[model samples]
Target: MNASTALLAAAEGGIIGDGRTGANLALGAGALGMAIGWLALARAGGGISTGNVRTGGMAAIAVGTVCTVLAVLHLATASGGPGTGNGLVGAIVAVPLGLGAVLLGRRALTRCRRADRPADRMTV
Candidate 1:
């Protein structure tokens, strides 16, 4: 299936178990993106030197985007209310988590760019 079709299926919880599955997936993606963004930020700040900050930042951005999209799609497709076992609450919660991850990733990317730039030289 195409990417959008797959994402729709995931949002509908058709790929696995019950209604909560999609929300759970979104939550996991958001958390992972946040972690990667944190690590990339640390690396940009010279706190570690094991991995490429740029790559980590890019990954964080991608994951965060996915999380947000999944959560939104779930929310759109979910039936009933928060207490109806439709995972409405979980999807709502995932939205902020995903947004936070995106912000963190963006910040890390900015820091990485600044760190990579060379010092300005005097012009004659």
Candidate 2:
């Protein structure tokens, strides 16, 4: 259910003879399953963290996060070996998307905050 539990389950039931965790852990489809599901609800909550968020940025973040999840799934299930998976492809997509989302979202938030401040008025 939780990440630690998913990880323990993965250790017991993951790729044979892995004896390790890396890309599989990073991608973490099993662990991410819960997180990805919760992300949508979190976005809708509209707290300080989620309110007035940029749409484009949010979209990128969601897609990037899922790409990472798929990447992990691919790595975990890879036949060749742990590091032999094509999940790097997912990482390639996710990293930039995630970074761009952060930058753009921050810029939008700054603009929103500035707009909320009162402006000076002049009198004759």
Candidate 3:
């Protein structure tokens, strides 16, 4: 009703209202997406015989990237105070998770390489 009251409500509600719920959802979804991507990447690099790991790995990374981008976008664009809509939170969370995925993938590749090596058995 009153201008001051309306302004206060808006301030508490965020830019698009609902206290930036949309942003929160987007950011959360992004994190989950990144996780899925990491799994795919690792599986691809692992010594698995099925699912075409190479292609799956690439696709997973791509999907994860998209999710991260969306999270950053929402966190930055949404209007809120301090931690409410800050992109740093999402980014910080994503970095470590992403790194872990990379490590797993690298390990898988190493295993695959070692497996390809000739065995130490004698040629009886």
Rank candidates by lDDT, best first: 1, 3, 2
- Model 3: residues with Cα > 4 Å off, grouped in runs: 1-38, 41-47, 83-124
Model 1 steric clash pairs:
none
Mind giving the per-residue lDDT tens digits that candidate 3 earns over 47-124? 344565444444445544544444454444446455755444554455445444444445444544555668884243
Candidate 3 lDDT score at position 103: 48
The residue ranges of model 1 lying beyond 4 angstroms of the native Cα positions read: 121-124
lDDT of 2 by residue, 54-109 (tens): 45335435544543544444345444542555344443343444344444444544
Per-model TM-score, in order, reads 0.93, 0.38, 0.44
Provide the overall lDDT of each model, using Cα atoms, as 2-decimal numbers: 0.89, 0.43, 0.48
TM-score for candidate 1, residues paired by index: 0.93
What TM-score should be assigned to candidate 3? Answer: 0.44
Question: Comparing 1 and 3 by TM-score, which wins?
Answer: 1
lDDT score of model 2?
Answer: 0.43
lDDT, candidate 1, 1-124, per-residue tens = 9999999999879999899999999989989988998898899899998998888988888999999999999999999999988788999998988888888888988888776677684232
Q: Could you say which candidate leads in lDDT?
A: 1
Clashes of each: 0, 0, 0
